[model samples]
Target chain A: MASPDAAAPPPTEPERWRDLDMLLSRPGNLVHSTFDPSPVLRDLIGSYVEVLVVGAGGLGCELLKDLALSGFKNLHVIDMDTIDVSNLNRQFLFRIQDVGKPKAEVAAKRVMERVSGVNIVPHFCRIEDKELEFYNQFQIIVLGLDSIEARSYINSVACGFLEYDADDKPVQETVKPMVDGGTEGFKGHARVIIPGTTPCFECNIWLFPPQVKFPLCTLAETPRTAAHCIEYAHLIKWDEVHSGKPFDADDTEHMQWIYSEALKRAELFGISGVTYSLTQGVVKNIIPAIASTNAIISAACALEALKLVSGCSKSVSNYLTYNGLVGTHIKVTEFVRDTDCLVCGPGTLIELDTTSTLSEFIKMLEEHPKLLMSKASVTHGGNNLYMQSPEVLEQMTRPNLSIPMFELLKGTPFATVHVSGMAESNGKKVSSLRKLRVAFKGVEEASKMDTTESS
Target chain B: MINLFKIKGQKKEEAANSNGGPPVKKQSPGELRLHKDIAELNLPKTTKISFPNGKDDLMNFEATLRPDEGYYLGGSFTFTFQVSPAYPHEAPKVKCKTKVYHPNIDLEGNVCLNILREDWKPVLNINTIIYGLNLLFSQPNDEDPLNHEAAAVLRDNPQKFQRNVQMAMSGGYVDNTHFPRGGGGGGGGGPCYVLCFWLAPPTLAPNANHCTI
Candidate 1:
């Protein structure tokens, strides 16, 4: 046996790179590679892997790193905006030299240099209404967008075809699946949407509608001053520089101040208007670490996709939110469709006349004033009157108060009446002035006299 | 000085003379495995292991850890560990004896580590669990938290969480509750009682600094 102090054999650098290179060269080699077979890979086979990264910002870059590390062969990144010096703070894929370059191009180039033998395609285009055509090329779509509108559009497009059917129903069909990543300050959330199976972001936010639809514009539009813009840009740059890096107390405090100020400005305006400024605040408060969290979430989503394709874990029809700051809390909530929704409601028919153009429809509305009469109004209860549509009126009438309103409107041409003193009626108070078309002896007599009454 | 071997020899003689068939030759396999696990423990330098019932009973032991970093710095925390006979296969029952202000750790000392719950697998060992516990001190997760107040503070104002932890560790009041001697498990029984005080409430002066063991 060798002595304890005997010179140890020279350490061997792990040949993991060579093995990885070999695996990359051979498509079939992925199967035999000694690297533990991911439960995700059991499903992803045969087809050329096409991934579309929607936001080439902080989270987008981190996700790119994770994807490249995981050995994904084909990657496509799309972002309309060019990189600014401010982005250097948290957008890891871009460098100081790449300040003026488009985010997508710079990120893709960075990926090429860092991870060889992978095909990365960069697109400098906005994912607006024309996203379907662009999105069709990719097998998977990952959203790192800040706006809920963009997220909703992506979600709707990915899950279903926007084309109207014979019944005028938007043919809800899955095109490409998507994953959504969002962050609020240090906290971050990642959710996977598998078309109809999973609870979409809309479904989850529907219960608490106001929380998701806060009135604020992007920083760029509201705070139009160049100084504010530059300041905001600086915040983004700070985040980009510190991407995937730990922050000290000073840095955290500075970022918190910048973000809180930006938020105050954004709340005063609107989110879209102040995009650039708010982007700065969002980046400072929710980049690098949050982005890293999002990357992990995106990777998990990719794994879930692989599992879904492989039939390991059956299509999970629920939204999974992973919160890293609070110790990896995972909440899976199911989505239930709202039957009474005006947009995606059940049994509600939408028949779009093929010959009518949008402008022509507007002209028709202007020409026929009676079409506007679809909304009829009635006034009741002298003072505290509130306006409501017929549907709301039908729902609000109680047996006791229902008779007086009906009696007052019996001879009127209006289909719906606005009820005043609703607060008092709701409070069970007796009112003296009973406004009516015909004089009634009392509420009991009015109820008895009505021919339409169902006793 | 008397040799330990001689004393053992005398005990064997006494046992043999008292009509025992034979002195028990060696410790059972269960005791042997427990001893090995205890001996091989790679506890941190800041952590100390003790047996309140003396060194003979390895089944019941306590681990004291004084974290040197993060919000819980300068705090002395003790955890009791009761290992079952089936040990490695079954997790040891761990209870925090010190009160800590943390999102993941409740007032009752219940922890929310995934390894202790659904994510636990047979492959994981005690070292991994201990490291995970240490990580909880370094970084507390606010989501899926046992203490909503701590979680909210951690989520809304991380600085406040740090301050609260510091105040609690220094044997001061946090949110109107006094910090226990070990952190959480000092007062034996009652609705509420001063942890370090030896005397009843009426006898003890309010200003006295009680440091009873």
Candidate 2:
């Protein structure tokens, strides 16, 4: 169902010819204008071209400029935060006067001023939990997000709506096939996710996890001074949460004000810190450029969306990352899905049935421990201490956990005991644990012999 | 034809008399192209270009930019440019000769600007590249970053970024390492060149002359 405002007259489309005339007639237009006079611009006129750009940062603005220049009719930009004075450095869409302004609004206005003929709608809202109706109207969605959470959410939403075929079979899968664009400093990536067709983000999650393994005490450790703590909180923590706030112009400005306050708090606190001496300045400036690259990738996603909507190119499901600094090296790879995936695996959906409730499932698991064993048997060591089923044991013994075991017998009534220790005549320690072996006859005979010996 | 030969001989004689150095040769078309690009460079007033080896060698030069804004404002930062003879066909090698706190520039001054590397094309001229460099000084991106710490700081605290820049320019310690004098250390016993002169406030304490080489 459409939102109440869906019926409301959509924002008035910009007068394309008026702006086009201005651009063409501008004095320096000949030198600045890079657009080719082609039929593409004429074809796009008056069409309700809906686009969803997820980021309103640097690359996002550039993409908007490109789209407007290319003559796309309708545009929507979604971002959660406002412009800071620092954003004026690389976010060319915002000027010093535009500091503390909502980035989406500033970007939309700039786009309108630079290139016209499209309806620009700025949403100062987070991308997560956005109404599907908002998504359905757009022919293409561009993800100019920075974090994995937003990227994953966008991917999930796309997967739920779009269906792709693999080997001519209609595969029903969740997690929409979408493009994820990200940048960190000067490096940027544009990844396309098609559920069941190409690899999902999860397939390549290991490539860019939270932290890489670093040796302990490899670098100097300094106490978090008040100023340093405040600085850390302002730049690293606040923006992360604030960037996900709902779409409101005032809320966006408040977030910028909060950032300013955090900066002041850090200065008052005087937090001293250390970092890799070589890269401090480079890191600071390059990051926004990288974010801008993400925006470009997001626009590229729009191009791909056009392809998908127009039945031009095959819907891509591969992942691609670009490192601009190293060279615009676009690394594209296919991601294979894990059959045993916890989220999208077969029959793994958590149905809202009487037996599927958390309490009921816990109770069922407690009552039928054997079911746990059956699942555990597929894993190694599950059968050793815990009574596991044969199915699990069979699965565990396949190459990865192929540890050999010996069958040991006790007294007369010999009971078969599986032990991991190897038999040694020299009696040397194996695996740093002392090993001892003893043979016993039949159980009844062993018991009688034990009794006789005791007597 | 006789006058042309005489003129050529006179040029040879002039070349020999000057320094008995290599004969003055006309610049190739490519060199001329690069020369025009460099000549037309409308660098920001904050940016100044110099040839460390002298004006005769335009292929190798340095650019010094004193940012008037952002976290690096008032700090004198120098970047060395080594353009190959095949420049325009290849991106120039740029290094941050200044040690400052930045996310995209490493301590060694190896910049991560995309235009200088992956995104470079022959179509891009010296003017565009300089603009990109100046943009870096004015706005540092924290999202896609080489210096994670600097990026994190810029992303988290713009005010702190300002403080760090001020501290670094004033020759104070940022974190622990001393901010290099004028963002350049006294390396190889080279005399420090004063890139820019600023009138210190009357109340501020007087100190040694601030110069950057």
Q: Write the per-residue lDDT of candidate 1 for residues A66-154, one digit (tens) a residue.
A: 66655465788888878877777678777677877899898888777666566788888877525345565556687777755567656
Lowest-sum lDDT 10-residue window in model 1 chain B: B190-199
Can you give the lDDT of residue B102 in candidate 1? 72
In Å, what is the interface RMSD of model 2?
A: 32.8
Q: Write the per-residue lDDT of candidate 1 for residues B85-185, one digit (tens) a residue.
A: 43443456565556677766655454555554333433454555666667677777665455567777888998888888777766677777776643544
> For model 2, how does the per-residue alpha-carbon lDDT over B1-213 read when each residue is reduced to its tens digit?
012133335446655644321222222223433544553456788888775563335577778888878667667887888876445556787766777667666444546565565445666777777777777777675544545566667779888877776776677777665666665542222112111111122234542122111
Per model, kept true contacts as a fraction are: 0.00, 0.00
TM-score for chain B of each model, two decimals: 0.70, 0.71
User: How far does residue A157 in candidate 2 sit from its true spot (Å)?
Assistant: 3.2
Model 2 Cα lDDT, one tens digit per residue, A61-84: 766765665456578888988887
Where model 2 places Cα greater than 4 Å from the true spot, the runs are A1-49, A69-71, A162-176, A212-299, A314-317, A342-455, B1-213
Positional deviation of residue B85's Cα in model 2 after best superposition, in angstroms: 53
